[model samples]
Target: MNTIWLGFSQKLLKVDRYIKKSFTYQAIEKTFAIILPFIIIGSLSMALSSSVFSKQGFFNQIYDISSWLPYEDVIKKVLEIINTVTMNFIAIMTAFLSAKYITRSFKKDEQIAGFTGAIGMLILNYNLASFTSDSNQETFLMQDLGIRGIFISLILGVFVGYIFKWFSPRNKQEKVDQYTFISRGVGGLLPLAIVLGILIGLTLLASMINQMGVNGLFYSLFRLTEIKSKHLIITILFLAFFNSILSGVGISGPLGIMQGGLDDTSIVSNLSYSLKHGTSFGVPFPISIHTIYDSFGSFGGTGMTMSLIIAILVASKNKNSRKIAKFSIIPSLVNINFPLMFGLPIILNPILMIPFIISPLVSMIIGYFFIYFKWMPPAVYNLPRTTPAPLMAFLGTNGHWSALFVSGIVLVVTVLIYIPFVKLNNQAALIDGGDLNEK
Candidate 1:
């Protein structure tokens, strides 16, 4: 083993320094840290979508408009509070992730604490901000405050580094000068102030405009006297249906097109949600890809109708395999449905086609009834499905808690739809190689 290790090390060291430095380690790091693991999000998405579409699904059971405050408002309120808190939470996490990466290199706990504080400021204490609009340059970066998060983290790291260095004797020098023009005297902090001023000024202007412009203008549009009271429910229903289907379409098509279109859930949900909000076309929203893609945005096609496909994949196996399949079922319930689907490649399989095709549509139909009859409200935005699909769907749609029951219903329906197909597919596979080619 030592000879092999030494031999490989010598061979690796023999490579050109420039080529090795640029690609080798960095390339391998990105593959495991970013790419390969990315596929798992796709699987998670499948679990998420299936959960949403199940008749016993979360969307159906969530809080409805009828449950407003004092009665069921408790339910709705919890969802609202979550949505409000998490709107830009992903972006804030991103900044911390960046800070964490930088700090982790030195094995310092202060790195996490420092970035967490800075992330809090950008998220709760500030507004959406930016520096550059051009996407082509390496100079571009963004976070919770949009581009402002990127700039602030750099500046804050410098400022924090200064305070930290002054207090902690081990590290006396900082890299603030990289961001600012000067590093000493009042002039040194001047650049930091300028950046802060711009952010503050832009935020003030935006706030003022909302108060004096769009928000005010829109408030009047929603006024009972200004718009028809009769059309309210109808408008809500249309929007609800459109939003639900639109979400499914995005997750199924563009997002998971790589997974046989509708086979993947994360891709479908995000793409559907994105296109609905016009994010794919450059418009950004609180729940847009700018906030979701890297983390929870890739689970749609992997989950939707795929959960049943997964169960089918597992159910078709031997008793030992069935045990494993049964075990995966519970985890899939909370949006971890990949153990069976990929475990058996039910992606484009002809037998498991039963659930793949029916689950989502059935869920959509059931979900539609809840919205149609005013049992639930539309999902207003995208929330991290990691927080349990029912709960997340409830909050994601802005206190439309009825979405939870609707989602639960969808879940039941998905399982039912898969039952027959799973049995048939299992029998066929058993006759074949018992692994797919035995026959």
Candidate 2:
């Protein structure tokens, strides 16, 4: 048994090393981790103003100064603007960050990389000709600039980085004082011009394809927002499982790539139909896997690792585990678990992989059944993905306390599920001569 375990550990470490070395994983992982603070702030802002909490939560009662203010509406608008600036431009920011990371990896110019990312995103999402022709300022849809565009932005960022790197002067023998600003400008100009021309050509091609009665590739990718039927439910379960597996191997899961296009419209439509017919919404909610996996299954980002943090804090016998728990507690509270996910180094660890992937699946199943049986109302409101679990359930269900209660129950259950795994992980660390006093 010990030999078997040893061999398994060795293989796990190998896979983990490969994943860490992959450039795509490193770029996406760093980009997501960097943007998490913004996600947390934006989520909190939305939660405070959401119908579920705007006039009812303890925050409203304690901070009722808005009621006394004559300019309460103005204050509300300012809050909305804050949320808009932070969360509404998430894709643009992610593009910049991803390109920046890739540029640094290639030892190229990071500032230009960020600029290219932002510029590419703009070209991909908007047509400059149409914008210049339109006199109306409200022509652009904000959703296209936010989470809806993340996948496109990510692709564009990486492409820009690679294109720039290729265009960078390579031969040291032909070096014309490349360190000078003049030499750098001369080298970079062609790449910038070439990329811009390619963007225009691609846009024209997409337009031509749309006019030719073909479903344009860009539109198909951007418009896949609703999932229906039992088949899609099974497909999403597999997608979630696959993403978790990737995450466990130290690769950033492709949630935004594989499932980002899906939205909460199906659940909203079901709720609307139920209201119109004066009947309770049922079974369909069981298949609303988009919101379920996001709000419940991803209790603490990718492998439901937040519960593991809780377990480490409350039940661990190892000092290193508790130290990691303390450091990760704040970020986990806001639904950012990168520190715990990588630091406790759940990424490469075999002992935790089973529960890491399965726990979220189990949570999804439970949340679905709970909603299906009317134990909790179906989530209708489209809350931010960064919304923490219990509040996520509440806001999503539009003030359904039962949903909040179920979220709490799920948290406890997740922690309980993580206990044995945490214990085993601690034992493995001890046996492998790993540090127990890590800060």
lDDT of model 1 at residue 308? 58
Report the C-alpha lDDT of model 1 over 1-439, residue by residue, as the tens digit. Answer: 8788456434433332233243222222221232112234343333433333333435423532243424443544454444334322333443344334333333333343345435434533342223333444322122233221322333344343333333332322444333333323333233334434544564456445443222122222223222223543333233223322423221112222111321245345655764586433222222222122211222233335334545445455456346446545544546454344334334334445435555554555565456546555444444434445444445655555466666666666666766756665555445443322111
Q: Ten residues in a row with the worst lDDT in model 2?
A: 210-219
Estimated TM-score per prediction? 0.33, 0.62
What's the distance in Å from true for residue 193, model 2? 1.6
**Lowest summed lDDT over 10 consecutive residues: which window, candidate 1?**
289-298
Candidate 1 lDDT (Cα, whole model)?
A: 0.39
Name the runs in model 2 displaced over 4 angstroms.
Answer: 1-10, 27-36, 51-75, 128-141, 171-178, 208-219, 222-357, 367-409, 416-439
lDDT of each: 0.39, 0.66
Number of backbone collisions per candidate = 69, 0
Q: Write the per-residue lDDT of candidate 2 for residues 1-439, one digit (tens) a residue.
A: 8888577666655554566567765776677666656655665455445422344433444456447647655656666777788778887897898887786567676667777787766666554335545665443345556655665677777887897788876535343345678766776776678778887677667655453111124445423534344666566677678778867754454566656445456766766765665443452544555557766788767777788888888889898668767766555554556556545667555667878888888888778778667777666665544356657777766677887887888888888988877877776666556622211
